[model samples]
Target: SAWLGALAYGIMKLFGPITGLFVMRFNNRAALMLGCFLCSVSTLVSSFIVSMEVLYVTYSVMYGIGASLVINCVMVLANSYFDKHLGFATGLVCSGSSIGALVLAPLSHFIIQTFGWRMAFRFFSATFVCVGFLNCCVKPIKRKRKGDYEQDKNNTIENEMSFEAKVSKRPSLFRNRAFILWVIGTAFGMFGYLVPFVHLVSYGVTNGIPVSKCTYFVMVLSGATTIGRLVSGRIVQKGYLNSLHFIQLCMIVIGVLFMILPTITSFAGLLPFIAFLGLVDGCYVVLLPMVTCSLVDYNDAILAWGMLAGTCSLSVTIGPPAAGALFDIYGNYNIAFHAAGAPVICGALILFFIPW
Candidate 1:
């Protein structure tokens, strides 16, 4: 499952630049609607796939295209609507994933137990129909015409875009020192960040924990993630710290957490630690784009976002397989986890060099 998820993300990187360009050039709401529909229809179609390779083609490739579109569109739209409170808005919106995890994780698990995995997929398919409908509510801010001096919401958007347009003309993102460092640092930072979530349940089960208890570890993580995102968003919006601080701190924290995961043998001992991991992960995801936006011109933020997406996609693709191969060799998650964590530590150290 982890490898397939990574593969799907890797496939999306093929479309990442296109998705970013589309969101930047066209109406993001329209792009999001199209993406939502693609996601829904593809998921509905996936219910009948029998072969694993076919599932990869349909579920991974098709769904990943839609997901890449939706991901970039959402980020662009979030910045458009709430530039003044970007951190808060992005965090709140992104928390939808955590909310889904909190609700759907247990629900899907229950449905799979009661009915089957197919039914669980069908159940999610129905919810996505509504997801497509609600996505229509997003309204992309437009470029304002001259003499539009009325004190209105659209005027606020125009004011923000006008400032961004000025900033965008100053320099190219490719030449920005901050952007280059952030991309390189984050690519390496991801090396260890996902190990626990990918292997947590199986690790717990191997250590004599009940299957249900192990599953709830993910639930606990989701709940903590919601809280972390809310808090981090608020903090960023308030100008408490720059996004780099959060990313660097999370890389260091998550690296340490990965090293400790293999040492934990009891369920009780893992909860506080996993909760911290979730919190760090929540901040990391929310801050990743926020940091990119900070590093580059706002007018070209979509391109920066695209680059970051590709970096992340490549890292996740290689990281899990690397960890898995190490596990195959060592016959345990310990050495694999330690190896995974080393790059994150290195990434954290690299972040200190960012000019921002």
Candidate 2:
């Protein structure tokens, strides 16, 4: 089950760059509609699957591709619509994922238990169709035409120079120092980002916490994450701190929290740690696109995001299993937690040294 989940996640991230190309070739609305169609059809087909192999094809690959397209399009559109208040707008948009997880988790559980897993998937299919309808509400941004630039005779030379510079520097996206640091730092941070989410409950159980109470840790984390997303966005919008600096601080805090997580033996002690980690994690997530926008040209934001996602895929895929392997060797989660914290801290330090 863990391997399957990882495969699904990995596949989704692997297709991030492709999704970017799709958006660039077509348009946001088309990409979104296509994503919605893929997701709806994949889920509907998954409902009738009888074999694990078929499940992988329908649930992992197809569903993952659809999800990647949807996510990238949303980020690109959010960036396009709001510039001045981009942070808050991104937070508002990304928070929906956490909200959906909170709402659908139990609802899906109820449906699966009451009816069956097939019914649960069918419900998901219907939900995606509803989401497709909502996608139609977003108007596509009108691209500027070459003739439009010709009408501005006074700034024609300047516009031409700017366009030439952009074309010439297009390849610099991969070579830019700031972007390189950002990607490295983000990759390291992501390496261990999902460790706690995957292992926290099991860790609590091993420490003798009641299974029922341990489950609430995730809920608490999710709720705190929602608050963190909103608060972080507001902070960025208000210009209280640089978004990159804020992201670095969040990474450091999360790293420290993970390192100290194993020291807490009781359920009550773990709640505060989980909540704070989730809060910082949430801040990091929403700031991703905001910071990506700052680091690259507006035209390249989506592609940069896609590149970042693809680069982090390996780290995210192996992080949890690596932690699990450590547990197998050490007979406890202490080393695993420490291992998780190390990369995040290193990633923060890498960011701290960014020239910009």
* Model 2: residues with Cα > 4 Å off, grouped in runs: 143-169
Report the lDDT tens digits of candidate 2 across residue range 68-142.
889877875778778677788899888888888888877888999999989998999999999999989878885
RMSD of 1: 4.7
Give the runs in model 1 whose Cα sits over 4 Å from its true position. 1-3, 143-172
List the candidates' TM-scores in order.
0.88, 0.92
Candidate 1, residue 315: lDDT: 80
